[model samples]
Target: MAWSRDEIARRIASDIPDGWTVNIGVGIPTLVPRYIPQGREVVFHSENGILGMVPLREDESPDPEVIDAGKNAVSIRFGGSFFDSSVSFAMIRGGHIDLGIVGALQVSQNGDLSNWSTNERMIGGIGGAADVCSGVKQLWVAMMHTAENGTRKLLTDCTFPLTAVSVVCRVYSDLAVLERDERKWKVVTLSPGTDLLEVRNATGFPIDI
Candidate 1:
């Protein structure tokens, strides 16, 4: 059984420390704000220039100007502040963000990330990923274990253009949670119905259980 996108978001939320300023990247990472555990206060920093983001409301009309890096309309907490993109990137590059949650195309055992584009075509601009990866104190990736074509994404080397090298500290996929140390990748947790053997088979590189 594969973890749903919400489940992956929930898993990632559990790992985020309370009181930390977090920058949620586009895609699955944007879902993380909704799953943050109760009793914890996390200040969400959007690359598009909003901080203290709350969950987006469906019933309520959205504010066009209030959006995340993905351009998805969002709500903010009581004390939220808005600024220009330059100020936002400054916050990211200044090393003020504690954690950065990003979606990745591929990650190597050595913690390299390649989420920007594929070799076949350019999907979109790299955006602030390069800065977020290098600026945050810790970087966590949330993505599918395999591509739509069933190609393994956790590999010995990323075929896509590198976004940041040796920057990923952890990965949360539908199949498993992996952590990287200086030398190797380790399986921290496996999704329900998945075993060490299954994870090993899916990944292109070896992972310690």
Candidate 2:
């Protein structure tokens, strides 16, 4: 079976190196903190100026004020700090973030990111995505392998608006984990019981083993 949203989040969380400062984006990326391997010490940063972010427990009430970039209520871990949006973006642009986990609408074989649009379902702007993609020391993407219409999201070339070019280091999809090696995307891991053919068929672009 394919990895569920939580499973995918867990897989990525377990792989984060200890003591690294990570800036997480919206969507499935928000589900990561709760699943970070216990005992690992990673600082989570949110674009809207919150650091040391923890997902609000279901039992917790919304603070309205303390939230992540997606505007989801989040709890700040002890010693966490808040800054203005400009300062938060400064940290990203200063190349202090070790890794960024972001969602995608499509990813090209060349590792371009397409996350924003001009139409409905859009945020009406790129909203810090460009900074996150361009400024992070390493950028990785989390998304489903296919679009809602069953279209391949791993494409020969992204058809939607691009967020950044050649910025992605890896992609964690529902079906597989892909690592970028120069011009090729290596299938690093597959979901249990999933075959390479299924992944290949699901990808719009050619991938390497």
Candidate 3:
């Protein structure tokens, strides 16, 4: 069976080092905080100046002022703080973030990222992606393995405009966990019932198991 969005987030959460500060990009990556391992200390950072973001409780009313970078209502953990975007960006650009988990439209075997836009139209204006990709010690992509048309998103070369080159260290897709070593892409884990052959056939690029 393929992993669900929440399962993918859990998988990514398991790989994050304890005590690391992580910037959770919008979309699927935003779900990561809910699945982080118990007893572990991980600080969630938002590009919009939120630090230590936690999941909102169902019974509690959401504060309109407390939101993540995606503008979704959220809660804050103990010691969480808020600041201006400039300060938020400084944390992102100054290499203070330990890990960055982001979504992608396409990722090349060479670790090229193209997530922000397709064609010439700007989608969401590439908010903080460039800085996050470059500033984090490790960058991981969390997204579906294929496009809506069933076209493989893991490719030999990205057709979309590149957001950053060779910055992706790992990818946690619904089907597998892939890592880039130098110039080679390898499958480090597979979803239940998925095999190396399936992964090879699903990807547009050659992959080592």
Candidate 4:
């Protein structure tokens, strides 16, 4: 059984503690808030300027002016507060957020991340990853295990420019849920159809699933 993307989001959401302030990054990171049940008392912060964002509207149109750090159109929710980019970033840098969920293109065994840029020269951006990775106590990375060409993103070491060094705590992907153990990655849950050996072959890093 493959790990459905929505199931991955729900699993990540379950890990979020009640009363926590979470910073959801671009990509699948945004799906976390949707899985968080109402009355959970979780406060969401976006890098652009919204703190306390509600779950995305089911049928509402995207707003041109309101956007996230990724510049995706967003809707404002009640109890949501808007601030300047500097102030919002200050909240992340000042360690106000408890948990951060970010999407990654690659992650090293020591928890280094590279999500902003691919091999392509023109579309790279580091943005707020460094700040969030270093500042937050808990960081969760979500992405596919392998590239379309079948190259693994979980590596013994990263080839791309790193966003932050040794900052990730856990990873959720189409394949499994993994955690960094000292200098190696430990697989916690195997995806339905995946076996341990197959995952081991995919990731060059030494892993005990």
Show how many residue pairs clash in every candidate, following the order shown: 0, 0, 0, 2
> In candidate 4, what are the lDDT values of residues 26-137, reduced to their tens digit?
8888888889876787888988889887655769887788877777777766788999979988999888899999988889988888887777652447778888888887
| Winner by TM-score between candidate 3 and candidate 2 | 3
* Candidate 4 Cα deviation (angstroms), residue 6: 2.0
Worst 10 residues of 4 by lDDT: 116-125
Tell me the tens digit of each residue's lDDT in model 1 across 1-209.
87989999999998888899999998899889989999999999998898898877778789898878888888988889999989999999999899999999999877899998999877687889999999999999999999989899999989999999899999999999999997588999999999999889889998887
lDDT of 2 by residue, 129-197 (tens): 999999999998999999879988888888888899999999999999999976688899999888899
TM-score of each: 0.96, 0.95, 0.96, 0.90
Model 4 lDDT vs. the true structure?
0.84
lDDT of 2 at 102: 95
For every candidate in turn, the CA RMSD to the true structure comes to 1.1, 1.5, 1.1, 1.9
List per-prediction Cα lDDT, in the order shown: 0.91, 0.90, 0.91, 0.84
- The collision pairs in model 3 are none
For model 4, name the residue pairs that clash.
1-192, 1-193
- Model 4 misplacement above 4 A: 59-62, 122-124
lDDT tens per residue, model 3, 1-209: 98999999999999988999999998899889989889999999998888899999898799999988898999988999999999998998898999999999999988999999988777888788989998888999999999889998888899999889999999898889999997888888999998888888889988876
